[model samples]
Target: MEYIVEKIGMSRTITVPSQAVTLLRVLDAKVCEVNEGIAIVSYNSGKKMNKTIEGQQKKYSLSSEFNRFVTLEVANTEAGDLDLTPLADAEVLKTTFTTKGRGFAGVMKRWNFGGGPASHGHRMGRRTGSIGNAEWPGRVMKGKKMPGHYGNIKNSVKNEIVSFDAENNIIAVSGSVSGANGSLGRVKVAK
Candidate 1:
């Protein structure tokens, strides 16, 4: 099953030394329409609402808070509160989120290219070294790691479940997930 979750920042477990974990909060969702196994779920997100969203809310007879709608595979048989029972048994979760954007980066920071030498001779400081090819193809390689848009891309990672607090709707995952705190993302039960 898929659920909308928010990144609640990172924390460490209180054991021998410590173990890093990322906390995620599951947003309350209502199943609006169900067909086969896929359903259209509505959940509260930001405060930005539009006429289209109001129309959807009116159509579904939902309140103003449930403004954002997304289609997900749900365990609900009919339209109502989304079934959270599947999450209780979820051990592995596949999280999908957009990474923090680093606009127009250099090769040193973007691709981690060892910049020029520390000495004061070469002029390769944070610049692309030699991108031109010998004259065979007469063009830079297609997949060359040149500076461009970095981050803000959709990334998916699998994390093991550390703990789940049903009362608080919080989940602690063993590894880190992308995106900043309070950013919304989707979590799928991988196993």
Candidate 2:
């Protein structure tokens, strides 16, 4: 099963040897539909819900409508046999989220390409040179690195859970996580 969480920023653990950790806030979720091996869950954000969502929530007998919805699938367990509360006991989790948008970037910043020398007469410094070859393969390679859009892409990272506050709906995980603060994240058991 997957749970919707919000990125709450990064912090350092207070252990003897401090380590970086990412804080995540578990949003309120309600099961909207239950099937054989799939369940539809709705997550509540700070924003107000629209009419369409409100109607769906009413149909499910939920008091409040949610801002986002996620479909969770279990291998062999039916919806009735699943328990969403197990997220608090997860040791290792895989988090999927979008990273911070970097707009248009150059090869140096995007791909860490070694640019040309900055000395005088080197007008092509910091530029991606030799994009093509001779007549044999005149066109550029398919996966050639070039300046273009970077970040804001969906990425998954496996993190070790440092701590969990079930009452407060907060989870602390070791290492960095994708996305900026307040960005949506999906957390699930690491395979």
Candidate 3:
């Protein structure tokens, strides 16, 4: 019984493991649709969702009112066994989502390249150094490390235990999860 939720915000003063805690605000997910052995869940507010979301809203009337999309998959049961009465009833198995994206980054930030000197005619600072030979092959080698875009790609992190607060509906995980605050994320269970 896995699902997804949006990172609403961070709790100002929540204690975590090492030192003090950084509470991550995640709303309870809504069970949208169940098919085969999978379930499509989401969290979104009517205000923030676009027109494309509004059209899909009709299919997920049973879900909560939040402005994000999350898909889920169930184990040991088909879609027929899905219970819609208790919307919040679920178990966390895994979370899948894109990480916090750092777009168009250099080798320094992207690959931890030690930049060159800041003064004295060192112009190639922070740039990827020589990639290939001059005339042996006459071209840059394949799979050479270079500056490029970072993050903003599909990622799946699994086997995270869910820590939820029944009173306030706040959910936390054992380790740090990906994506910036308020980014959409998915949670799913193995079938």
Candidate 4:
């Protein structure tokens, strides 16, 4: 089963040699329609809404709080509240989230390039040093380790479930998860 969740940041368990865990809060969602294993689910997000969302609310007979809609693989057989039973029995989860964006980065920060010597006469301190061959392949090659955009890309990680608080809809999983705190992501039961 899949659920939309928000990253609650990372914390450590209260035991001997505490293990690091990433906490995720499952958002309250209602299944609107089901087709095979995928269903259109509605959940509350920000207050921003448009006519299209209003029409969806009318069609699904949902309240104004449930302004956002997404299609997900759910355990519900029919349209209703999202089932949380699957998560209780799940031993692992595959989390998919976007990494933090570090826009317009340099080669040193982006590709971990060792810059030129920090001497007084060196002009290639942080620049890409000699990116071409002498008349052999005069142009810079494609997929070179030069600087450009970095991060803000989709990343997936499989984590073992540490604990699940059903009443609060919070899940603690082993290790770290991508994205900043409070960022939204999807978690699918892997095991």
Candidate 5:
């Protein structure tokens, strides 16, 4: 089963001796519809509900209108039923989320290209030089590293569960997770 989560922040555990962990809060999700092995779920955000969302909530018999809806493929079990309760018991989970946006970046910072010498004679410093050859293939090859936008892309990371607070609906996982604080995340059992 999959769950919609929010990144709380990163912290270090005192007992673990310098072990860093990222905290994730599981948002309240209600199953709206189920078909075959897929389940449609919805969860509310901080924003207030609107009329259109309210109608969808009423149609699904949900307590309130949710800000977002996600479809999750149910993991097969011996009983041939979708078991969502195992999400809390999972020891390791794979999280998918967007990373922090770095905006526009140069080749030196983005691709770690060695910049030109910083001497007075050098006209170009921290610039991508020799993009293409004079002859032979004449054009810049595809997939060549160039200066452009970086980060703010979907990323998935496997994390080990450090601890879980079921009462508080919080989970602590080792290592850094993607996205900034309060960013939406998707968590599932690591395959």
Candidate 6:
């Protein structure tokens, strides 16, 4: 099964080592419709959305303001209890919550491309050097690392142990997730 989650905010570190805490918002997930080998889980929203979004929601009963939905293909159907109450309001869906955006960034920050010497009088410092050869190649090769969009990509982080509050029904996952606070995150099982 898959879940649709949200990037709520970063949590404060409670234990040792001092690592940043990542927070996720897991709505109540419900089995809307199951057909073929796919389970269409609805994460439903109470807010009003645009016509296009409303149409999609009506067609699928998807929960959430944004078009953030995950499809899970069933490998086999066995007699089991799939606890989906977490999708309702208890369990914080765990997934690598990508950011809404990070604009163009240099290789140094993006790919950790160690910038050139800072005090060697080298002007090429911090710049992606030698994109291609002189005349033999004639053009920049494919898959060349360069400055570009930094974040906003869905990255699945695995095995985030979660702690839930029985009273409040707020699920807390350890470590940093991603994205700015209150951004829509598509949560799914980590493979």
- Which candidate tops lDDT? 4
Off by over 4 Å in 6: 12-20, 44-48, 52-94, 114-125, 135-139, 189-191
Predicted candidate 2 versus true structure: per-residue lDDT over 115-191, tens digit per residue: 99898888888898888989967898899999999998999999999988878888899999999899988888773
- Candidate 4 lDDT for residue 135: 89
Kindly give the stretch of ten consecutive residues in candidate 4 with the minimal lDDT sum. 130-139
**Residue-pair clashes per candidate:** 0, 0, 8, 0, 0, 9
Residue pairs clashing, model 6: 22-175, 26-93, 27-87, 28-87, 28-88, 29-87, 43-63, 44-63, 45-63
List, residue by residue over 1-191, the lDDT tens digit for candidate 4.
Answer: 99999999999999998999999999999999999989999998766999999999999899899999999999999999999999999999999999999999999999999999999898889988878878877888888898899999999999999999999999999999999998999999999
Q: 72-126, model 5: which lDDT tens digit per residue?
A: 7655323222345666678899999999899999999999999999998997899
On residues 78-106, what C-alpha lDDT tens digit does candidate 6 reach at each position? 31222544434433343756655678999
lDDT (CA) per prediction: 0.94, 0.81, 0.58, 0.95, 0.81, 0.59
TM-score per candidate, chains pooled: 0.96, 0.86, 0.67, 0.97, 0.86, 0.63
Q: Worst ten-residue run, lDDT, model 5?
A: 75-84
Between candidates 3 and 4, which one is better according to TM-score? Answer: 4
Supply the global lDDT for candidate 4. Answer: 0.95
Stretches of model 3 off by over 4 angstroms after superposition: 8-33, 40-42, 45-71, 75-92, 159-162
Q: Which residue pairs collide in model 4, if any? A: none
Distance from true location, Cα of 42 in model 2, Å: 1.4
RMSD (Cα, Å) for all candidates, in order, is 1.1, 3.0, 5.0, 1.0, 3.5, 5.6
Tens-digit lDDT track of model 1 for 71-116: 9999999999999889899999999999999999999999999888
Worst 10 contiguous positions by lDDT, candidate 2: 74-83
TM-score of decoy 3: 0.67
